[model samples]
Target: MKQPPAVKRLFGLYFHHFPFVMLTTTEAVFLHTSILIFAMFIAYGIYSYLPATIMFSISRASYYLFGESNTLGANTLQY
Candidate 1:
């Protein structure tokens, strides 16, 4: 009668985008779908990674700034 939480969440996410999804059927549609899913995964990964990365960077920088050294903005990408 009831679905599990993970299943519900999964379906919820799928249905949430269902209305906007353009259903397609053409030559090599499976290949195109695979590529699109791969791109979506990459985008989602980067989207999820960004906040944690910035938080860790800021935390490490602040630690170095206050506790370990007086140097701030020492690391830079030289191009």
Candidate 2:
């Protein structure tokens, strides 16, 4: 048996809609970043992730500009 056309169309619209926002405040952005970093730590404990490591490296690489840390620079250089 098939659903009637009206009901099917309603379901189609409902399924395709995605309401997530693309931009947000700096604090909200950083809060999510911190949460992700914390989650990454938990994930790493379960199974190491290369992408998360690379993201951390790129973020830290900025510190090299102010001579705060060379670790990020070295990481970017290697990968």
Candidate 3:
């Protein structure tokens, strides 16, 4: 079955916005450009996740940006 063009476009938009909605950083990093790609990954993970689990990791992602080094921060963790 073919999906409608509108649905596909919506998915693309969701994926694009996924990164921004996921990464919640209070402290602005001095090196922001470097952070953008990685931030997107975090967003992807958040959106891909089931609702119940998203919050737990979302908080961790926030802390991860604050210089905490862990697998979660790296987007290496399996869902």
Candidate 4:
């Protein structure tokens, strides 16, 4: 049976943007899956480590800026 026009157009678009001269179905699936997994790993790393890193930086900055003083209202006005 012949493919529908929409299916033909989709394939045309896919090939038009595809970088490789040829790609088997399995190769395409593996390539896409690897890219997705790599992206997820990067996202997970950022999600796990970014907040703690940001908080640590903020805490250090505040400590340096304010010293050990308990009087924040007065110190804030001085700067």
Number of the top-ranking candidate, with TM-score as the measure: 4
Better model by TM-score: candidate 2 vs candidate 4:
4
RMSD of 3: 18.7
lDDT of 4 by residue, 1-79 (tens): 9999999999899677876468778888887899799999999999999998997777777878987544334356553
For model 3, how does the per-residue alpha-carbon lDDT over 38-76 read when each residue is reduced to its tens digit?
899899888887675777777677776776554444666
Residue pairs in collision within model 1: none
The digit string of per-residue lDDT tens for model 2 on 1-79 reads: 9999999999778445623244357766686688789998998776767778777877676665656565534556443
Using lDDT, rank the candidates from best to worst.
4, 1, 3, 2
Candidate scoring better on TM-score of 1 and 3: 1
What TM-score number comes out for model 4?
A: 0.62
Clashing residue pair totals per candidate (backbone < 3 A): 0, 0, 0, 0
Regions of model 3 farther than 4 Å from truth? 1-30, 51-79
Q: Which has the higher TM-score value, candidate number 3 or candidate number 4? A: 4
Task: Using lDDT as the measure, name the better of candidate 1 and candidate 4.
Answer: 4
Q: On residues 1-79, what C-alpha lDDT tens digit does candidate 1 reach at each position?
A: 9999999999889657554355555634775688799999999999999998998788787886787443444575557
lDDT of 2: 0.68
> Alpha-carbon error at 78 in model 1, in Å?
40
The lDDT of each candidate is: 0.75, 0.68, 0.69, 0.80
> After superposition on all CA atoms, what RMSD does each candidate show versus the true structure?
7.5, 17.0, 18.7, 8.9
> lDDT: which candidate is best?
4
Q: What TM-score would candidate 2 get against the native?
A: 0.30
